[model samples]
Target: MFEISPTEWTAILLSLRVAIIATLVATPFGIALAWLLARRNFWGKSILDAAVHLPLVLPPVVTGYLLLLTLGRRGMVGAWLAENLGIVFAFRWTGAALACGVMSFPLLVRPIRLSIEAIDRRLEQASSTLGAAPWQVFATVTLPLALPGILAGMVLGFAKAIGEFGATITFVSNIPGETQTISSAIYSLIQTPDGDSAAGRLVLISIVIAMGALIASEWFARRATQRLHGN
Candidate 1:
């Protein structure tokens, strides 16, 4: 009853690939934005924060629709990129990754921002006073201290990406072997005859992956707290 067929395996592998690519590509941006939000107090900061977290509050379908309008084949930005750079997003696996990344970005940034905020400014100041350049201080002090949060955020974002349904499907249309993820595969399975068993198996897989990610997040959080407390 729990057997996973080759097609299901394909969906599973594709989901993993999309999630990984999304998380990796979004991490640096997450870190940079996190630092900005945590350390800076510029004009329109609140607006930027709200924009960053918009996906969290908006319906997934709405977010996906917005992405389509902005990045679709006929979209303003999309058309330009396709015409000049030959890059396409709509109806592609890369589109799925983009949707996942955008959807998971809020989750990716929050913990990182909190972690950066929790870091000791005095440590940074001391490093700077010791002739370390700004980049050196950030690399040696800020980044090390924020590693736990970054890992936690990445795990959270990855888990979210793996389960993403509405945005990814809306953007990429769930093409098998190209853009089909586990969630979309499960959705398709449940709509077909004799697909219950496959859907159930995928559901179990999703549960396991989510539980593992949460566990890993907890472990990282604990380690972060311990390190912060000098234990």
Candidate 2:
């Protein structure tokens, strides 16, 4: 029962690929937004913050439908891209990644924002006084100080991406070997008469992956604290 089949392996691998891509692509944006929210006080800041966290509160299916309407083949942006750039997001693996990224973005930004907020600003001021350029100060002092939160956020985002189902299936249609991920696979499996064992296996794997991510986040958090305390 524990032996995995080819199709299951495919789903597992696809899930990993989608999650990793989503996390990596979203990280830089997450960091930038996190910093902006943490450090800046521009107009419409509250609105931007609310928008960032909108996915977390919105129903996943609603979010997916919004993506489809905006990025679907006939969508304004989607049509322009398809015409000018020959790119598409609807009913594709890339769509799956996009959906996952949107779904996980809030979780990705929160920890990083909190970490940046927790930073002692005097260090940044001191670095500036020491003739460090703004970019240099951020690179040397701000970024390093925020590393742990960034890592934690990445892991959390990856975890969310891997398990994403509603948005992924809605946007990408769960095509096997194309857009089917572990969550969608399990969803399909449990609906079939002879798929109980397979579904059970996938469930177990999901549990393992989630637990591992949580543990890793905790470790990163501890490391961050230790580093901050110079221990």
Give model 1's TM-score versus the native structure.
Answer: 0.98
TM-score of each: 0.98, 0.98
Candidate 2 residue lDDT tens string, 1-231: 599999999999999999999999999999999999999999999999999999999989999988988899988888999899999998888899999999999999999999999889999999999999999999999999999999999999999999999888987898999999999999999999999999999999999999999999999999889888877
The residue-level lDDT of candidate 1 at 97 comes to 96
Total backbone collisions, model 2: 0
CA lDDT scores, all candidates in order: 0.95, 0.94
Q: Once superposed on the true structure, which residue ranges of model 2 sit more than 4 Å away at CA?
A: none
Superposition error at 185 for model 2 (Å): 0.5
